[model samples]
Target: MNSHPLFSLVAGLLSTLLMVSCAGSKSYPPLATVPEVNVQRYAGHWYEQFRLPNSFQKDGASAEAQYTLLPDQSLRVVNTETRADGRQKTATGRATAVSGSSNARLRVKFEGLASLAPAAEEGNYWILQLAPDYSAALVGTPDRNYLWLLSRQANLPDSTRQKYADEARRLGFNTTRLLYRPR
Candidate 1:
């Protein structure tokens, strides 16, 4: 019988790859959000202090988000960013508060082709941490793949940034993965 060594090697590699993938996928406890969110008080302009790397927001020097309360109680989300080339990019979206979540969870849908990605469609926009004064916030997805630190002020204090990093770490996020624009 003629045995092909290449076939066995390929099968072994595939097995190893599958095992590694399965072992690397770690499932955590259900992501928790603050008890409640006052969408009315949350409405206003916010500066993106830090975020996990994502494809759509690449090349941004600075980013800001504005929220307007709609008549239907949904939120009008307008995100504007200054790219490294000095041009500005803006996107508009709608955020409908998830029912019975005390206005905490929101299903956000950004308009345009960017919405086509199934990976981005899973809307958790979970508010993991919110400042009592609403001055700073830590937002992340349940899957732990996305995270953002925001502040109402353009320049957030160093202490708050540290708090964000600590909280994110405690929440099963790798703080080292967070990206921030230099102020």
Candidate 2:
């Protein structure tokens, strides 16, 4: 009947609208990293100010990360966090600069797997922003799915924290979801 054709048209239009909305939600391209990173100045302990929710650090509190330069020119990364239950957890990993990335992009691999073979894949760690004094840094993945605001001290000034959050917003992240780490 005529109703059959009308229903088909409506369904087609609805599908097209759904597709367009989905595309709009992913408007931003992968994030960009700073042009260069001075590895020496970047190496040190940084306390987490805030971060996007991640399964690995679910319910983590007082999270912190330490980066040390290794003899091989690689980086040793240590991440420590306290759980809500007052238990401390730590993870150690190795990071190497992505060749030809101006030391701004790094590939990191954490130890531990079902087999002894080395990890075939590495996670992308990009330095998005770094304060001139190297006292504060903003790091995230190219996908913009992960973000962290870190500072040399346990507590960063409120103004500095807001500035970083604004930067993240400009970078297309959902800043409202950023969770603060315990002081």
Candidate 3:
């Protein structure tokens, strides 16, 4: 079979892309969060600053989340995302602190369609970094597969964004792939 030069070039490019995507950050110890978190202070609306690409939030634009402190000390999470066409999607869930956790780690269960009860699949949401005034935060999962940068304001300064990304990189996360959502 005759192999075309263009075909060979395309194959090489694809292989490189695969390798880059598969190779994550270097080995590191478990991810850690702030020593203490005041859940009440952290409860409020936070705009999506930057995030690692994930299928769950693919094609989402103008994403934001609002947290409310429940009476029972749990949290009510409301996430909203608008599409380019102005269509909006929302997911509401409840978050509870992990036992012995200082309100930094939480388990959230969102309500799925057609289910009166909470979804069985609970995801780990950890607050890796937080501003003293609760103005900004860096949230991620245990394995570092998912990450989100949140801010109280919709428009975050470029310098602050870079600072957060650098912090994520220091925490053993691959921030090169972080995507900024529409304002």
Q: Which ten residues in a row have the lowest lDDT in candidate 2?
A: 114-123
lDDT of 2 by residue, 1-183 (tens): 254776567767865875676575857766778888888888889999999998778655779899999988788989988888888888888888987778888887876661232321323688889898989889887657689999999998788999999999999888999998765
Q: Local error of candidate 3 at 93, Å?
A: 0.4
Instruction: Mark the regions of model 2 whose C-alpha exceeds 4 Å error after superposition.
Output: 1-24, 114-123
Model 3, residue 20: C-alpha shift (Å): 18
**Model 1: residues with Cα > 4 Å off, grouped in runs:** 1-23, 118-122
Judged by lDDT, which candidate is best?
3
lDDT score, residue 183, model 3? 55
Whole-model lDDT values for every prediction? 0.82, 0.81, 0.83
Q: After TM-score superposition, what is the CA distance of residue 20 in candidate 2 from its true location, in Å? A: 13
* Candidate 1 local lDDT, 144-174, one digit each (tens): 7688999999988788798888989888887
Clashing pairs in 2: none
Candidate 3 weakest ten by summed lDDT: 114-123
TM-score of 2: 0.80
Each candidate: RMSD: 9.3, 11.0, 11.2
